[model samples]
Target: MASIEKHGPSWRVIWRYQGQKQRTTWATLDVAEEAKAIVEGYRGNRTAEQVYIDMGVLTPEVPVPTTPTYREWAEKWLGSKTRISPGSRARYKQQFRDHIFPTFGDTPIGDITTIAVGTWVNDLRAVMGSPKTVTRYYSAMFAPMKAAADQGIIPVNPCKATDFKRDQRADDDTGEHKAVYFTPHQFEQLRAAFPERWRVLLDTLVETGVRWGEVTALAKMHLVAPTKRTAARVRVWRAWKRGEGGQRYLGTTKGRAKRSLPIGRDLYDALAALVDGQPDDTLIFRRADGRELDYSDMYNDVWMPSLIAARRCATHPPAPRGEQLAGATGRCRDYGGTRDSGEPCGARVRPGTTRCPSHYGPARNAVSMCGCDGVLVIDQPASWHDLRHTCAAWLFSDPRMTPLMISRRLGHATLATTSDIYGDLMPDLEESAVDAIADARKSAQGTRGKGARRKR
Candidate 1:
């Protein structure tokens, strides 16, 4: 039955919605009419209605285990990831500590929302972390949450919906860095500044473009003569990793790369010539204490001093250049140097790329060639990494090699990556691209002018 209630002399109709059997109240005729319209619109029947219930739906709070702090989980993940080659594992550990743990470590995973994750990443970028660095941090931070989601411990991953927005280059940038190459002149000045052994280290690194750790890990055993099944080559199997546990084991190659490098004429001759009289298993580069030289000490004592010396040379050095250390040269050695190995150069370390240990470093006193006081001489400033950059640059700068090939030569994961960093080096070609398009446009305009004249 419908009833009319008096409200300030205006009649209000009260009615039931579902059916006589099902009791659902509507305050007025208009309310009943609107509710009937909705039910009809939804289910094609005005009678269909469910009682609105606002009771309880609890969000699953992901349990943060009390015994294991965020630090413990991070450490465990690092420890598990240590199966990878030592260098990569060390980087993972560094990323977790420096970026991941501090912000979200104590927070329970279930409570972390996508918006919060995005905000944290934005904060990290504001603090000046590189895109690459943040990318790694993103992976480490979310991996556990993802696992928790899969295990039904959490409803969703906080990091699941977020995309790292900073990968696009800064609007002012062209996504390329300028070239910071080591001049031949600077190389010479640098050579004379360090010990004969260090000179060899620097020179060989430039010529071969092998990493510092690779050089440090090089033992006489790894550079063995070839057998019947394979050609003569040097194995790049091991590297000394500096980490919490001290020197950790590294290297089995990342993907398709063979752990050994082919020792062709340059490498074969220099290594053979340099190590001719020495024993087979000797460490190629070692410290005074007979321990492997820590990478930092190697740079601080050897490479950096060489750079300082280069600055002192007569010719002022160009300020630091490009993406790579910009001086890692490589391939092999043979000529110049004038050593007793019976070869032409004998690995005496003249100034070109291929170099051996004995004549490796530059003169300690800065000559006019480098831009510094000629008075001081000891070690030069140069890290093996800078030398690696130099080596890749050497390949990229050549006319014959394409950027794609260079990427492969340098063991980069993708071609676009190599081009992104070094695209500016090939300025002529980039300019040519714009010119080519402009020329085509002009040619088309000429054709259109001819057509209009014909019409006239």
Candidate 2:
């Protein structure tokens, strides 16, 4: 015999199982109906209630997991009983807990859809999260769902190839220009603004575009002697933990890291001094006392504070606008202050415009230093890296270099990627005015020939 009754707002179904009353936690009336059918079927069959069989009338197609909840699967995806970086794994857990499972946690993987993900992204974006992050989290959060999809638990992965819109968080906060970085002169000014140790850090970053992690992972072993045909080199073979724990890894780059860069003689001297008398195992970058610095440790304790000390952020004036004082001459003006000074004294800034030309000098922001002297930098708006754009622009303009070769040297993954960044830097050699003038000259020559024939 079984008993059925109502409790609170929803109907509660109770029954006798092994001579004891049992209740179902069907939160809704619709759920209760399906649960009631399952109970009734079991009662009719006289089957024991302890059995763990697939049973759901309404969502019959979705076979019940022994326990259907996101919390169960997420733990498994965090790498069960394995040795991985704490930092990396924490992010995995955070993404699942914060983003994915909350929205679709209760829904069966079988019913997940592209539209569902799209809608969720829209809602999240409305709340002011960056679309780029949403996309990244989508990859990590759905690993289990991917497994479920493979087992026919779901039909498709809606997260792949998604169209994400850029977020306006930075714009909303400070109203900065969309692109920011140093020009050669500004970088020189900012670099000169830095202390010796911090000078090395900023100069390297402006030169290589290396991520903070790669800089920490750098070791004396990475540098090799130069050969006749090739220049001296340093390799980006490892990185400090990008994951949760402070574990160091042998290989992995974050956001444009892990590149083998040619160290010009000037940059090489700075690096060589840092790693002098150290074993191959010792890192190239270090604290003042020569201890290996973790990624965040360097950025917080040293990098940002150094910028503060140098007054880089404080001295920044508004960006330069329109045509700069320098024309096609390519001859730079005398702005004082070196990269190690951090003053706004000697930069080639156009007053009130956002342009800083030095950061993008000949080396592509690789080592865009200026030789100008005396003036202390007052204001800067662009970043130390936007100079890379300035440098990339120069490479594209020269007919002697192809975009492919330039992209390879720049460590861009593809020609298309390089083109996206620096394509417009190359002008159309088509020169309509030149062609029109040539046509006029040819017409004049023809008229002269006709006149001579008439005279003959």
Candidate 3:
């Protein structure tokens, strides 16, 4: 037991060690409280002299073994990791530098408490929008502390003691987000909106559900033409990856497993046209200069523009009966009008008002002659990864495709991975699962009836 009390113009922490009472006096109450904490923690198995040394009450005959700082231990832990990919290693380093180091870099590894680690995680969850992203950073921080524990540097890993259950929000909560993907109709409109040159790339992505890196790394040899006994397929064996040093190269697939996905005749023809007369080693999808397409450039320059154009066409269709349909009363509002080019005046205006003189009316029926006319439009936002989810959604909607089949098609590491993501989306699968148990019970009852009749 330890207690802190006031002495003459100072504070004293009194405790017992090795059956003898010990006391340490400090100039301030804070210092006395800190000494009290040290005394309380120095329980069984710790050397008798450690308490005195930790409180700076006694000088040692030899140098005391000091615990490494969080940064020092983290560097050693990261260096010892050799099995991870260069890209993964780079990401881990980035997570440490950006998220963990600022708060705990100089803190002694042994001194970091579970409460401190838990507080850091909560702060990150507040600052970062996504819980999954926060979890990744948490894992990066947890690994080093776990290694420190294994190496006898600390008594326990503080991170392991944290209860993450409290941090999780319900699916419908404001901060929580689920997978975002385009519906089939929306995808069709989006695909139609893309330029002719890049349409096949989008087709391949939606059909096979391969990752962006995996699709970009595809070569002519990876595509296999249909035969008498085989279906047209694409072999996914490798992917384009960047290392910690920022060098790009072909690397193993994310799961380090090779999967061959059967493709439709339409997609096969599209892919074959790209690889026609090219060497087997030639990339199936690349820039005209024979360079791999960068994600940032493609997203900004192509995907976004195409997506916006498609949404616009969906919202605004061609004028009814060749006469521009205006508003609910079939007439333009005070601030709405057409320009000299016969296009609607798209100038910005004040909300809920026709005050701007730049146009005839503030509101009008959407009227645009675009390729996506009469096509279902998608207003929801999406990203490149959503293409993969789109494929999964499509597969789940089809009765012919089972969950296991969808998992393999998406190149998921396990069926559980696929189910964890798209399981709730598959109402048919859930119904079938219920029916299977019902059918099994009926079959068992019938079998028992037959046995009883035979015995009779």
Candidate 4:
């Protein structure tokens, strides 16, 4: 039995169990009444102590652990990732601060539901407008929640329960381009676009398929000069990486795996020339000042400029509507384009435009060609990683190179990873496979016919 009585500044709920009286205090009459009702409801079958625990008046013998908030648990999860690279740690921190924390930081891990995760993903897609970026951010957030579920802190991982595959299918239906890699001829044009000093760097990238970090971190010691009986080899053991505060440092390769890549004699000689007379520890590809190569400086100052120069597009000054204009050539007029120097934009404008595509705005085509030189315009831009893809593309073109061999050459973690990425680029290999099957079937049929004739 239970009852409530008004006390000074507080209300008291009283109950009797095992012939003893017990009481609990509440701040409000409503809470007091509710506590009384809870105790009364459970008094029939449950013991007094159990009723007291249900009423929030007493602690149970076995304490239940409190479920941590997403933020708290995520911090624990991050701390547990001792083996992740510095760059990965920085990226995870960024994702937590900028993306994950905003949505579910304060929510209890147990309270995070699949519907909530789906809604967050949809919101991220709408705001970010890049499914790939959304996926990257989501993966950072997913790992923590998954750990929570594994530890039974939550019933299940909401991130995993969310229908990401269905969303990906929807993205595919929207006709997103899956990959970008240049043909050998296109790669040559791009290589020729670079200056003589940086040409070997581009060649190395397209030839070996090493990552930007790996290529930039190359030292003289990594290169093995060509021998009469064996081809030249480059050891990929380290890479330049960013850590906390964006400080650059030498780090292990992406897979933490060391590999040796065979290079052509010409490429080997060129690489050797770059490091000639330098110390064994000196970077093969370095800045004019002998400092490490910075990606932003190289991309904006060198890579993009070279790409535009390769286009060799015709350019014209701004002309009034219906006015016939003579062609003009030179630097972009857009303000603050180069290093915020406030000078005219240095990026080359496409033919018939006053500003470069960056300032001129988006084009409405997958590819555009320069009317003058028939060069592919920069509408479908490629990144440094595309050079790695280009290497894979070239390797896949060779019938002698199996996916497993290509995987080893590319330093991919597994053959499946190689297939997943470059599968679409292997149409010729697929055709060869079909041709081999047909040839085998024909040989089998010929043998059967010969046996029949011998029996006859």
Worst 10 residues of 1 by lDDT: 51-60
Instruction: Write one digit per residue (lDDT tens) for candidate 4, span 404-435.
Output: 88898888888877866676877788888899
* TM-scores for the candidates: 0.55, 0.54, 0.70, 0.71
lDDT of 1 by residue, 74-123 (tens): 56656655356655666667777687778767765644667778888878
TM-score of 3: 0.70
Q: List the global CA lDDT of all models.
A: 0.57, 0.56, 0.77, 0.76
lDDT of 2: 0.56
List, residue by residue over 1-456, the lDDT tens digit for candidate 2.
344466777766566664656766556777666666666644422222332232332333464444334455556646663645666677777777787778877765544555676678777767645645655666675566666545554434445424532332323532222444344665566566566666776766666655556667788898876778988888876666644554555555542435677877778788888778878877787766777676556555654444443442333322322243333222223333234344543455444322346532222112212322423333343444454555565455566767776776566767776665554554543354577789999989888856455545
Q: Total backbone clashes of model 4?
A: 0
CA deviation > 4 Å runs, candidate 2: 1-86, 142-152, 161-179, 246-251, 254-259, 294-456
When sorted by TM-score, best at the front, the candidate numbers are: 4, 3, 1, 2
Encode model 3's per-residue lDDT on 220-255: one tens digit a residue.
999889999988999999998899899898888888
